[model samples]
Target: MVHVSIHSGLLCSNAAVVRSFGLAPKYEWFDTPEPSGKNEVLVDVLAAGLHPRVRSQADGSHYTRPRALPLIPGIDGVGRMANGQLVYFVAPDTSLGTFAEKAVVDLRRSVPLPETVDPVRIAAAMNPAMSSWVALRRRVDFQPGQKILVLGATGNAGQMAVQIAKLLRASQVIGAGRDSDRLKALLALGADEIVSLADEPERVAKRLGEAASEVDIVLDYLWGQPAERAMLAILTQRSDRSRKLSWVQIGSIAGPTAAVPSVALRAANFHVLGSGQGSVSTANYVAELPALVDAIAADKLQVNAVPFPLSEVETVWHALSDIKERVVFVPTQ
Candidate 1:
């Protein structure tokens, strides 16, 4: 058995985790676990993504809840193994999460990282970028010339959806966001048009309505008010009722549920579906990573990542309010 020192955030079963937020979990030392499974390898963790979902997992609000206490609090990370090969891997079990100096993951769950790619960038980009890439590539039968409308385009995931759509040769990409400045930035990131959702519902509807005639797919991240508005807009612009539009619901940052109108569903050419865990097969999602990481290495996927030390999780954790950049935690040497 190889013994290694690790600083991991321990989640207590009885603790009110959500109330603590950036202050909870509290890191402590632990002996690394021995690997014992098919393709299982012990890894020296380099960088772990401080994703918003980690907080949700700790608080017991995420879809994938913590099954036991004293759990580490990372969903995924980039690590260097005993063999000296660097890879990115996901934690199938929350009991042995990625926010540590060492972890054991099935080698099949990991994708080998190129030497040219920064591990921090890959750690930050994959979760957010994969939503749309896998959704468009697997969920929907997307063609090169198809047009895409990205709802909540100002957020990190939405921004990545825009980039992926363009990289996949989307003929037209419309970005909808509440922030005009960020929406303008999306234009340079390959978005052909921008729709501002800061206005009243009627005005937002009008904007979406104008573009509804051209949108072949809608990648919705904010699936509350903006989604309702988009639906209303599509209802008004149903030029060809026979032409179906694919709407892939990925995240619900706006709210858990929306007040979707019954008429809106019956009136338009809309085929709404979800794209996340349990929605897509795990093996297929893993298959897409090599090429996706290659894209990041080639600088095709655009993402801004800010590195912080694992020891400073309490200090810098509160600074994750900026959705434009990803906050990554590098294990302290």
Candidate 2:
């Protein structure tokens, strides 16, 4: 493998190093990674979000998990280059990730951010917001005036999906989630209507059909039973079954696989697509970053984020399930 020269004086730095899967990472000193490719540059990591993707990666459960051990567990973060330029970067799937004070980032995969932007907020909001932002912007022919239903809208990413759909000029945005309070709160974030998914199967289906029968797009974050139920409800209630319905699966918070029936595909003009790492081209993801960054930088979308020092990673990791706000690790004091 190609390696770049680094000053002998700056060999190591403290990081959240994971030596094995299914365990909380340890904060310890580790060798700083060097830029190994032509377009890569060494960056001083500022903040890395503790997203579900990172958790899965750390536990070796993510589909794109790294092959080796002693890995850092951050998929993306905000960092500063030697020239003092601030940027939001996606870390490559490697042992060296963004949970450390230093990381090697491919310049092509990063977006330069305004120096005035809050690093913690940027780190917290980007990954979650990108789920729906890229899904609607890149995954399908989403148009203004189209109606949308965001499954699992109470969660972080799903909450942003509600506002993003409105930002994209959807005529109607329906938010559905298990929490009644959170579903009601989505109204202020631009959801025209809300559906509670906490009800029994029959009632949940009835509510979904009533609120989102004519929606043109569905941004599904909860895939297993919720997705299957929503699909059947919308299909059965639609006045025009031939009307196009684009279901973009961004996450599977409920479960990985959905038991979709053959009739759901054959009965109507239903199109199910996914929008994540493999589905969207890296170039496409990078291309959409500027606009997304602008929105976050300008405070167009509400971001709920909490910051914790990198040294406290182990404590934070175990307590993450109880935290609703996005937890961002600050590598520097």
Candidate 3:
């Protein structure tokens, strides 16, 4: 085995360190990371969001799992460099993550943040909002007047998708989910209609068909049975079968695989595509960050963030299910 040093030194920093998969990270001191390549800079990490993607990364369930153990577990965060410049950084799939007191950031994978901006809010909103933001901007030929339906619209990222679809100028936005309260809440977030998935399968299908039959695009976060049912419902109810419909799969909160009928593809001018890490190039993701950061800074998007000390990472990890707001870890706290 390759022996690694854990001794505290002048360059040591506190972080939530994961020694193995399928366990909570331990809060401890580790050597501070240094910039090892061109355009890389060390930043004092102020805030890192605990997103579902981060949870998956820690548990070794994410498709792009880290190669080795003894890793930090944040994918993106807001930090201040040695020169006092604040920035939002996206961590590569490596062991040195943003969950530490300090992190080495690639300048190309980060964007300068306005000094006046709230780091916690930026840290919370960027990763979740980027799911749909990058999808509409990068993956598809989304037009301004097109209509949209967000399939798991009550969740954090799903809620952001409703607002983002509106912000991007979609003519009508429909929010669909199992939570009635959250579905009702989406109306205020620019969802023209809401469908609850709590009813019988036929009823849920009928509701989706009525609300989103003619939608130009579907931002699907739930990709299993719900998605399969919604596809059939929308396809059957569509007045113009030949009208192009783009289905962008961004997450699989419901299940990993869908038993989509082959006839669904043959029925209309339908296109199903996935938008995530591998499908979107790093350059494309980075290029879209400036505008997204600006939107969050300008208060165009709603953000609810709750900060916790990084030292309590283990406790917080277990309590996440009870927390409704986005959880942000503050290293200094």
Candidate 4:
């Protein structure tokens, strides 16, 4: 089979540290060639997202993958194949990333984009949206009618989490965030109520405490003292004396360390677990790809996205680093 390739890909490959997050870019545009294997499909990268965590990986702070010099750092993107089908895939490592004109990843990792969906729109949902989908599906052990609290609710992953909870038909979806402006928007995105984090945690806790009986799960993105207090208050005041709380930690945008009370947790059957989308096996990815794709195609899931052309990657990376919202980079356009 004959294949075409492009060389221009966004890079953390530079020797100079990018000013945005105090990290050095290492990966250089070594190559952008097509795959020769049967199970691997070369995707023409149209768009990619600049995840802040990718910067962490560059700085050698991200808990996963040790920092290796000269690695392309991107976690997600959308593109098309030689067959002309639109597909989006989140290439895990800082290697073989999607910040390029083209990328060749395994066939299983790619999900088909619907004909009606713009490539940029589909690409926008690749990174943060998957966090919501994968976390709720694999970690939360969520069931219909289970009430859940989503921290950082106005955020990309938070918003997506709210939508995923409703997709599962969660009982009471509470969205928590510092932005009341963004909170109000959650009403249409399946959040039954929005809790602003701007106020004191105690105040927010008291407000939620009244309805605590209905909350069964907590999807925590903010991990500071506020989150700790909120969790504690909710756990202690829940009306359903037997309401078991399950918390899934997906992010730490607020802060890393938290004073999690072991004694407080023991009060009820509360369970806490960390989720980082542990290396996905190829077979399992194949299975999950279809449903995830169908959800995006059907518009069952919504994502916040900003589209940019490939050449603007340098400026765009800065934009991504500064803004606390979702962004998608379109390459072929």
lDDT of each: 0.79, 0.91, 0.92, 0.68
Candidates sorted by TM-score, descending order? Answer: 3, 2, 1, 4
lDDT of 1: 0.79
Question: What's the TM for model 3?
Answer: 0.97
* C-alpha lDDT of candidate 2 relative to the true structure: 0.91
Per-model TM-score, in order, reads 0.91, 0.96, 0.97, 0.85
Model 2 alpha-carbon drift over 4 Å, by segment: 1-10
- Best model per TM-score: 3
Q: What is the TM-score (0 to 1) of candidate 2?
A: 0.96
> Could you give candidate 4's per-residue lDDT for residues 14-70 as a string of tens digits?
111232235444223345544767867766677777666666665557777445544
Worst 10 residues of 2 by lDDT: 1-10
Cα shift from native, residue 41, model 4 (Å): 3.3
List where candidate 3 sits over 4 angstroms from the true fold: 1-10
Worst 10 contiguous positions by lDDT, candidate 3: 1-10
Where in model 4 is the C-alpha error above 4 Å?
Answer: 1-30, 33-38, 92-94, 279-286, 321-325
Superposed by TM-score, candidate 3 places the C-alpha of residue 236 at a distance from the truth, in angstroms, of 0.7
lDDT of 1 at 201: 89
Overall local distance difference test of candidate 4:
0.68
